[model samples]
Target: MSLAAPSETAPTTDSKVVVITGTSSGMGLAAAVAAAQAGWRTVATLRDPSRADALREAAVDAGVELDIRRLDVTDEAAATALVDAVIADYGHLDAVINNAGAGHLGTLENETVADVREVMEVNFFGVLHLSKAALPHLRASSGRLITVSSVGGVIGQPFNEAYCAAKFAVEGYMESLAPVAAALGVTVSVVEPGAVATEFVNNINLDRDAEVAAAGAYAPTLRAYLERTAAQFLNGAQTPAEAARTVLEALTADTPAFRLQTSDWARDFTAIKLTDVDGSAVLGLTGTWIG
Candidate 1:
């Protein structure tokens, strides 16, 4: 990924090149469209490009074109190859949105460690692989690196041990990298969103009845957690488009913050954990989620 020199470029309200993953749906799709609309040379990527119909339709409707490609973020080789290709074709990569992840709903007692590893491979390592592969190019362009994390990253939730652990890993990794990356002329930011209206839940592919049947002593607590979580998503979820706005801001801002929350609710939810010294506040708040 050696380059001639750093240059001001592509999507951040410029013709700068930006690569976004998981754009087949959700915030990824919306952010890809918004970046294109904002005058970026946007590369929208997904695990399977064949499922890009909705992304294509959205582009056509928005009257903005995008370079859609296949990118399984979990594959380090695939990530590096696409990045090299983007650099060769576009000349520079000014920003990246790491948003490719599947949903997982399980507790350690009910699921094997293999399940947790699979979740980490996508949610945590996926971001790591793509971001690592793109670092040289981003440094060459003094670019922005943003990831769409969840509030779960900040607050551990019941029945979501694997997902929360992975996201927490992402947040910690990025937080530690921010200062080091900043010195290298790259901006790193993590955007945390609360529950959003998207296919994220359905994408988990969980069979509630089967999971409950296998829960043994933990079935009742799991049921309560599931019910509460469903009601929250049903009654108080933000739109993917709404969440995408924060990601866009992180892309183009002259001086973006190291951390951002998609909504006020997300801000408040994470605040409890941030300000909690003894973990009592976070525990008290998350405790009611299952009760």
Candidate 2:
């Protein structure tokens, strides 16, 4: 992985230093672009340094430079070192975005423990390590911590047990950090998103076909549900650029919201507090308790 220095023309700003992880693609890339476009000094870190061409191009197109680095979120020591380096150079850190995560699809029974652990390590532990490293800088600068969670973190979805668990854990962690962060003049927000047309789903690690085979029986049911949901969200699914803008707004708002639901489904989920419903009420629909 090769680290690319920010271009000479890269946009510069004071008191707006940001470090974003998993910036090689998707939301992270989009967020970095927005920050750079807005003239914020951005440290964009991707797992593979060689793959930062797109980010650099985006920054160049925006007439700004995005300082690029190679960062593997799962590596604790590396995360710490990178945080130190950013603080050393920038003199202060304004925000940290933990967007390096992947998904797994299959039944809990069918998925191996190792698979579940791996999911947690990246989605949950990665945030933990990165946040821990950045807390001090955040305290000094009165910065914000924004994490990319999922609607799955808000509502349980089929064949997403491990993924949901990791998201839920993130929510809990953020909630616990709220007060501590607040006392130090820092804020935290979790961006919960519904399905966006990203390559994220395509990258799911489903090594066992038997689980997929079992899930195949419900393919029609799932397909119908997904189609209906997608149709409703596809139009509203904010592009990566749009989502990044929202994140930036959240970070700099005079009074930032603790949770940001990017789409209608996420908004509805948050509005209703789905966890308040009982199993019987959930089981009984339209005066029919089929289950």
Candidate 3:
């Protein structure tokens, strides 16, 4: 997959211009194929094109071509250049899905400063860079900026500080960006999925020995907690295809929500937000209640 500038032609009724990142596997690949099937000229960008052969084959099997390109989301210069190239080739960008992300499984204390930095670099800064680069074309087409965030974006879970921090940052950034994009006729959405059985978790970077050696004093508790979370993650999870549909809906629907949570657990968590804080006080003894 060599990099080339986009063709200088306008998009026709039969095609839509879309750029999807992290399409080598999981939700990103699913969204890319779905968009292509929906009559879009899909550009599937991955860290390494060679690593995306399976995805490329799958897209072809579906009768849609995924123009694979080498893209590292952290490379702002390349991202900016690619955005301009896409606009030039297709005349406009219909949507930009920031789906390229990686997960790290460990405790904050056990992970080195370097490890935390690497996590933020890909999960947070990558989305930021790509979103900034894609804005002009998205603005021009009145396009949508959809992010594949996680349930961690809202809730704080055990032993996932770095990953959670990155997601939290993504949520905050998208919230600020959405209102501004709305004024430009562009919509921004963050898909905060819960426990999707994507390759994301299965392929988590868990270099425990290295991580532990880096934090000798703090390793034991962090390691144990991470092990527990890993077990829980493996026990119950939704399929990536379902998550793909949720992302697709957010993309093409007439009225899309700013947030979409894709699990029963997520639905319950959303409902729980309505409970009054005073309800907790009622469970305490009368002496403990604040009259």
Candidate 4:
């Protein structure tokens, strides 16, 4: 990937600095460019800087520049070092966007313990590592801690046991931390998006046929769920740009909401749990997908 430098006008002392992870593609890449265009000194990090072509092209097209860096959020040392380096370069770390995550699609019977662990490592523990590394700097700057969660975080879906588990952990972690972070002058928020039209589906770490063959009694339900999910994606899925805009809103809002959804569909889907503690609303709705 080409590493394009920022415009000739380098970031000034007063320019706000924001770090976003997993900007190789999808919403993270869009958010990085949007943030830069919005006058932020954007530090866009990816697991492999070599995969930053799309992000660099988008930044160039937007007539903005990103301080692209290599960061694998799973590495605690790397996460801490990146935060330290950003603070040293920008004088203050203003915000951290934990957009780095992976998707898993399989039941416990089809997925090994290691598979579950890998999903949690990227989707859940990655957030924890980056947040812990940046918390002190964020407190010092009254910064924002925004994460791109999924509708799955709020409502568990069929065949997404591991992914939903990880996202649920993230929502719980952020919701619980919001008040404490507020007391320390740092804002914490989670952005949940539903069926985004991105490479996420293509990038899911699962072999559908293999999973179905191994599912035994669960094969029919798993197949039905997958077919329905594909239909939903085809019918109407929010664009990555739309989701990125929500991330920007969460980052720039004066009084940011603790939990935000990118689209009305997501909000309505998540609202079921809030309105019905018994979870019958969401459970019944999801059951239709498997049937």
lDDT of 2 at 239: 69
Estimate candidate 4's alpha-carbon lDDT, on a 0 to 1 scale: 0.88
TM-score (all chains, Cα) for each model = 0.94, 0.85, 0.84, 0.95
Model 2 residue runs over 4 Å out of place are 5-15, 205-211, 214-236, 279-291
Most TM-score-accurate candidate: 4
lDDT tens per residue, model 2, 14-102: 64888899887778888888877776788888887777788887777787777888888999999999888887776788899888898
In order, candidate lDDTs are: 0.88, 0.76, 0.77, 0.88
Candidate 4 minimal-lDDT segment of 10 residues: 1-10
Worst 10 residues of 3 by lDDT: 282-291
Worst 10 residues of 1 by lDDT: 1-10
Instruction: Tell how far residue 74 is off in model 2, in angstroms.
Output: 0.7
lDDT of 1 at 74: 85
| Residue 199 in model 1: lDDT | 88
- Candidate 2 least-lDDT 10 residues: 282-291
Candidate 1 lDDT tens digits, 20-70: 999999999999989989988888889975678888888888888788888
Two-way TM-score contest, 3 vs 4, winner: 4
Question: Which stretches of model 1 miss by more than 4 angstroms?
Answer: 1-14
Error of 1 at 170 (Å): 0.6
